[model samples]
Target: MATYIIGDIHGCYDELQSLLTQAQFNQNTDELWFTGDLITRGPKSLETLRFIKGLGDTAKIVLGNHDLHLLSINEGIFPNHKKDNLTPIFEAPDCNTLLTWLRFQPLMRRHPAFKFALVHAGVYPRWSLKKAEKLAKEIEVQLQSENYKQLLIDMYGGAPCSWSNNLTGIKRMRFIINAFTRMRYCLPDGSLDFKNKLSPEQTNNANLTPWYEAITLKPNRSILFGHWASLMGKVNKSNIYGLDTGCVWGNSLTMLRWEDKKYFSVPSTIK
Candidate 1:
């Protein structure tokens, strides 16, 4: 059985289907893993979510920043952005059911047999895989709890860029959420930079390092991530994979087949 790890979909359902076909995906045997951002800023968020949800056990996804934003908007913590055009989601018949499933999804996932792991944006540079998984689970538990709205309320912002075992409450949750779903560049001291979204080659700042570059992970730890379309899937490191290819921004959607490391892509069909 083959496992396919795909980059941020961003609601490009047509592209997703094409990519799957290009990869020769067999829904009965091949598993589809996503790096997140399944919806938002694309032409078919509702259709994308419905198709993946209908896949049931065949599909797995981590939560992305856009996905979290959808939850916050649903809970009235924030208003819908017209640019994102998420009204179709709220108007769907199984909207609440779809959201309930979305929120329960994890922030990081490790392939059960493979040495690789997946996160939306990145793992904290200083975090070990075990530590990262523990912290990710903390937010997942909060999201699964009845007080999820409060978790969403507290999860905004980029403060507490530095990590410490002493961090607690909202500060801790924010750090974990930002690192997993919104982070880009990181400082030498392992502090996160939320402002810089440019690719490493475009950045003139010598002190700023890509999170994967700054990471001290063991050589055995491989991570696949999305959320930075400007990267266009170029991290240049063998162990760290950047899968987001700006599919929602008129670029192509990309995915990698796990067994042979073959990539498949489909150009955007949005107009």
Candidate 2:
């Protein structure tokens, strides 16, 4: 049973199915790990959510920023943007069920046998594996609780930019959310930059570095992440994988077969 880790799907259900066909994915045997952003910006958000949710234990996921934004929109904290392509999800009969499942998903996951740590984005440069895991759990508890709406409402923004163990309340949660979901380029001092979206080669600022470049993970600890579509799966760092191939932008959807480390991709069929 090979474990297949897919890149940012972003509602491209047809491509997702075709990639699964290309990979020979066996729902009853093979495991599927999603790098998240499962909805938004593609053609079939509802189909994507329903299909993945139906997978049950066969699927593993870490929620992306778009997934969280969908929850916020459900709670009336944010307006639905025309560009997000989330109307199909909202119009679905199982919308609440899908969103609730999404809300319960962890911000981080570690596969013991594969030695891969998964997050929608990169880990903060300042956090150790244990600290990052703890912080992720901290927010997860609040998110799953009855007060989750309040937590969601407060989790927006770029604040407390630097990590401090002393940080408390909403500021602490927000920092964890950004690092796990929205992080891309970071300043030299290990603070999140939040600005530039260019590929590393295209960026003019010499001080800015991709989050993976700024940190040295423990030996044999590989990090698998998506959400940086501009990267197009071209990170030169060892044991660090960027799987988002910009499928929502009419590029290919990429996946990694962990055991043999083979990659399979399917060109987007969406227009």
Candidate 3:
């Protein structure tokens, strides 16, 4: 049975199906790993959520910023924007079931045998694998708890950019959330720089570097992430994979098969 890791789906259900068809996905055997942002922006948020949720053990996922935003809006902590295409999901008859499943999803997942870790975005530069995993569990517990509304309420914002082990409460949780979900470029000192969204080579800021460029991961540890669509599956490093091909923006949806290290794509069906 093969495992395929898909990029940021962002509600592009048709393209998702196309990619799966292209890959000849076997739901009865093959496993699917989603890089997240499973909803919003595209035309079929409800369909996307329902389909993936139906996959059960055949699918694994890491939560993206958009996914968290959906939860926050559901809890009435954040306002949904007019341009956002989440109404279909919010109005779905099974919305509660879908959202609860999303909340329980982990921020990061590792496959020791594959020698890779999957996250929606990058890991914190200051965190070791063990520390990052433990911290991820802490927030995951909060997200799955009865107090999750409070977690959503406090999960917004960009602050305390630098990592410190002493960080406590919401600040700590927020930092972990940003690194695992919203991180892109980071300052030279290893602090998250939320302002830059350009491809690494295109960034004009002298002090900025893609988070991966400034950090050292464990030897032979590969990181598979999405959420930086600007990169378009390009990163100079061999061990780092950026799978988000901007499918929601009418680009291609991508997937990488881990065993053979091959990529497959399907052009967006929207527009």
Q: What is the per-residue lDDT of model 2 for residues 163-222, given as tens digits with 9 covering 90 to 100?
A: 888989999889999999999988877788887788998898998989998878878889
Ranking by lDDT: 1, 2, 3
lDDT of 3 by residue, 18-120 (tens): 8999989999999999998998889888899999999999999999999999998888787877577888777888989999999999999988688788999
**Separate clash counts for every candidate:** 0, 0, 0
Task: Estimate the TM-score for candidate 3.
Answer: 0.97
Clashes of 3: 0
lDDT, candidate 2, equals 0.91
lDDT of 1 by residue, 62-181 (tens): 999999999999999998888996899999999999999999999999988887889999988888999999999999999999999999998998899999999999999999999999
Question: What is the lDDT of every predicted structure here?
Answer: 0.92, 0.91, 0.90
RMSD of each: 0.9, 0.9, 1.1
- Selected candidate, larger TM-score, 2 vs 3: 2
Point out where model 3 deviates above 4 Å: none
Candidate 2: regions farther than 4 A off = none
The Cα RMSD of model 1 versus the native structure comes to 0.9
For model 3, state the Cα shift of residue 212 in Å. Answer: 1.2
